[model samples]
Target: MSLPFILFFVFALISVGGAILLIMAREPIHSALALILVMMSLAGLYLMLGAEFIAAVQIIVYAGAIMVLFVFVIMLLNAGTEERTDWSKIAKYAGLPLGILLLLELAHWMAHSLIGRTPANGAGSANVMVSTRELSMQLFQKYLFPFEATSILILIAILGALVLAKRDE
Candidate 1:
């Protein structure tokens, strides 16, 4: 196989392995770290696929911002490995079946819909797509409500965190 092909496969494997670790790790901090790794691997995959903007966004928004927030929440809540052990047996029983069902549904969707779909030609090219411009336009215009709603959600999350952290006066 070509070098690029090999690298692609390796990144894909790393991404999937990171996802598994994220799901299976007992410690919440470890899971968050694994999830960060998964996001980084996915960003690498996006780079390989020529989605440069998407790769950068994935790294910045998901790997940097989102996972850092998750790690902060875990530390702030003082969640520890002890809580993990308490839920281990029941979680395994519930998680395994749920994971199996999810895998089956994903496979079914892939087989029926994704296998036959051809990727849009020139879709990843910066000059051809101008995706950032188009996305900004949509965000400010047609999809403004959804964008505002997401902002509101973030505001609510901030408020909720403050409320949770406040000590009795």
Candidate 2:
């Protein structure tokens, strides 16, 4: 009924619908696009929750960079639309029960959280990385080595890809 609740439902529906479409889409590219819709809707939900940094990361990293990578890989592989196949009885029947269970869990969580929660004026104390100061402090002081290690790992992966592409004849 309230604005925030309405917005939450809107974004939640968009995210869930996108996820379903992503799974149902036959083409790899369409699936990737559907995933982008899900990611962007999740970013909206993050913004609604006052997690600005996470929302930005969701948009920039997952929707922007990762989706681009997914699209590129799909194109590079020349992936085609999936061929329709007969589904097993177990798989077809199992989906409804699983969906209902997930729905019940989500309803329980929302009922608890929305009933008594007040909106924080800004990112709450528990929200790490809400500001650049905390993020930079942790990044440079605490997690610097891991950050550099991941960068090195990415470089190695790029080199491996190049090597594989230019294999000696």
Candidate 3:
């Protein structure tokens, strides 16, 4: 097998394992760490797909900044282990079947969509290298309004958070 194929499997396994651990961990801190592992593995997969800029953004924005924010909130809140609740029998029985059905549906959709599609390679591939300047130009020129709106929304959220936090003190 090719090196990329092997690396893909490795990253996929780590990502899946991390997701499982994130769900299963009782402690909030451990779950956060597991999420970080998942994010990093996803970044690796993005890198293998030739999306270096996306991979770097995934690492820097998600794994670094977002995770720090999550960790800080967890610590500030003094979060503890999750409390277990008894599951109703109907939910216990129905949830598994429903989840399996959803998984099967997704798999069928993916298989149908991918069956006739040829993987792109060479110059025709979608993985063309784009310069940061071109990317910034597109972002600022074409997507400027949406980007600024998003920033404004984020600023509002931050201000609301500060107000709530100050109110609590």
TM-score of each: 0.69, 0.72, 0.82
Against the hidden true structure, what lDDT does model 1 obtain? 0.80
- The model with the greater TM-score, 1 or 2, is 2
Q: Which pairs of residues collide in candidate 2? A: none
Order the candidate numbers by TM-score, best to worst: 3, 2, 1
Q: Give lDDT tens digits, candidate 2, residues 1-169.
A: 5677788889999999999999889998999999999999999888777678789989999999989988998999999988987887877899878989999999999888875575553333245336756777898889999999999999999999899879588
User: Which stretches of model 2 miss by more than 4 angstroms?
Assistant: 88-129
Off by more than 4 A, model 1 = 1-4, 23-27, 48-51, 73-80, 83-98, 116-130
Q: Which ten residues in a row have the lowest lDDT in candidate 2?
A: 120-129
Candidates sorted by lDDT, best first = 3, 2, 1
CA lDDT, candidate 1, residue 46: 81
Report the alpha-carbon TM-score of model 2 versus the true structure. Answer: 0.72
The 10-residue segment of model 3 with minimum total lDDT is: 118-127
Top lDDT model: 3
Q: Which residue pairs clash in candidate 1?
A: none
Q: Per-residue lDDT of 83-169 in model 3, one digit per residue for the tens?
A: 976877877899889989999999999788866684543222335655567878899999999999999999999999888878543
Error of 1 at 108 (Å): 3.6
